[model samples]
Target: MGFPSISKFLFGPLVPVLRIEGIITPNTTNSIGNKLRKINTSRTEGLAVVLDSRGGSTGQCQTIRNQLLQFSKDNNIPLYCFAENFATHGAYYILSAGNTIYVNPTSIVGNASEPQADIDFSQFLLKNQIESRIIASNPLVNEYRFNWAIKDSEKDKKFIQEITDRISKLILGDIQVSRGKNLKVNEELLTKEYTGKQAINNGLADQFGTYEAILAEKFPLAKLDHTSLTQFSFISSYQWNSRFGKAIPLFLLLSLFSLKVFIKYTLIIQSYLLVSSQEEGQEKEKKVQH
Candidate 1:
């Protein structure tokens, strides 16, 4: 849900490391605001911040960018980007907040700027819905058909293009200013989003390496907090440990029943084999006597 433990101790004569993740937006800022506040003063050789997210609201992106930029300048510590996966959108901008950006070659640093706008627009719609409810409750606009449609063709087109241009510029500027940006991406104004190979060719990511290389280069003693989907747990196991702390009995009963059935079937098979062998031995003795 959030970054683990505002700090981690590292190798090399007591170093400090930090990590960040998720969509970079207002909540992202809120989530880390306390952590950031607590980190007003810390002297260290370098600071490493890792990000793994698809990005979030632009406003949030701007807030985080400004906040981290100030932190880096004020504290005089080098900030780095450890790209674990697709560091897309606002996440990419956060990576730019660092002094150096590192990427795992196979890992993706995606370009999904359009999605960020979609999120902001979703928020705008929610706001409008609330306002519409207020208007319905109010004495105004209930008596007339509100002309929400835009009849101005030229104005609408101009407005649309202006917003498009603004979003494009925001995305372009973020990429251009990234710490790992070796050079400007070709393609005028980035008409299309780039992926791993294209991103590298376009200079979005500086260089790629294995996990070991990346950690050693940036966070020599960085311990990745990772999760795997392969872990399996039986339903009855939950009751035995009571992770929920409720100590439910029904699940445990079902588990024991299943085990008992298995044991019974196994015993039956063993008895059947033993009886068949004894009967065969008697038949052979009768044949020998005859």
Candidate 2:
């Protein structure tokens, strides 16, 4: 466990800082969900989430966004989120679920780019003078192959476009519902990216502030409480992974030690049995000779 984990576990009125960094996969969503469920909000003012991600899986992002919304509503507490570096695509979708969003001046708020099925590998293949062949019953299966020669058909292109449009609508709808009149949802704004200051002005973010600044202002007297040592940090997949990462080596060592002892005992028992059988054989041979 890290210092932050220990500090959080001490039952102080500390604002729980949940990190939404890296790829938004199932693990990431599970970690966030764990923290939301374990947080003892009664001892704290509110929850603060720091989001710094380029983007991630859209489905996972939707799951996390829904979880955050439900957590805020169920707790009847404010869930503040701050965009640290770049909160675009799926990251932006999750951020919108928070009660209020804050951002730094240089923070990248939104980048509503649609998902694309095609990746250009023509230049690399040409430079390497390599030819690739893909054999599949389904055309869609061949899409995963590195075929610079193959061009997407009209049907496939339309399918991709439809999915992209649906995802965009879902994300935009969530933001519109959450931000309400504060956000002016126009085609131009949704398609383009915005900086932290621009995000605040456009009502995509509530204010331009960092996590520390908001925490200090909201919970001024939240200091260390040394009276209780029985508290625990918010349970999250990240925390569990952190502890598990450390425990793996120790568990391996113990397993190896047990295996060594078992082997040693087995060898000793085998040797004793072999000696006893040889003695019995010698006695039988002597009796036959007599």
Q: Judged by lDDT, which candidate is best? A: 2
lDDT of 1: 0.56
Best-matching candidate per TM-score: 2
State each candidate's clash count. Answer: 0, 0
Q: What does the lDDT read for residue 219 in candidate 2?
A: 69
Predicted structure 2: lDDT: 0.74
* Superposed model 1: Cα runs more than 4 Å off: 1-18, 110-158, 178-181, 187-191, 209-290
Evaluate all candidate structures by whole-model CA lDDT and list the values in order.
0.56, 0.74
lDDT value, residue 241 of candidate 2: 61
Cα lDDT tens digits for candidate 1, 1-290:
13222222111111234555765657678755555555424224455566777777767766777777787787776665667776776677666666666676555675635441211233455557733233355543423222233122455446556766687677666656563337465425243445556656766666565444555555433333222111121223333343334434755888999999999999999999999999999999999999
**Candidate 2 residue pairs in backbone clash:** none
Prediction RMSDs, each to the true structure = 18.7, 15.2
- Model 2 lDDT tens row, 225-265: 22221244344455456546766898899999999999999
Q: Indicate the TM-score of model 2.
A: 0.65
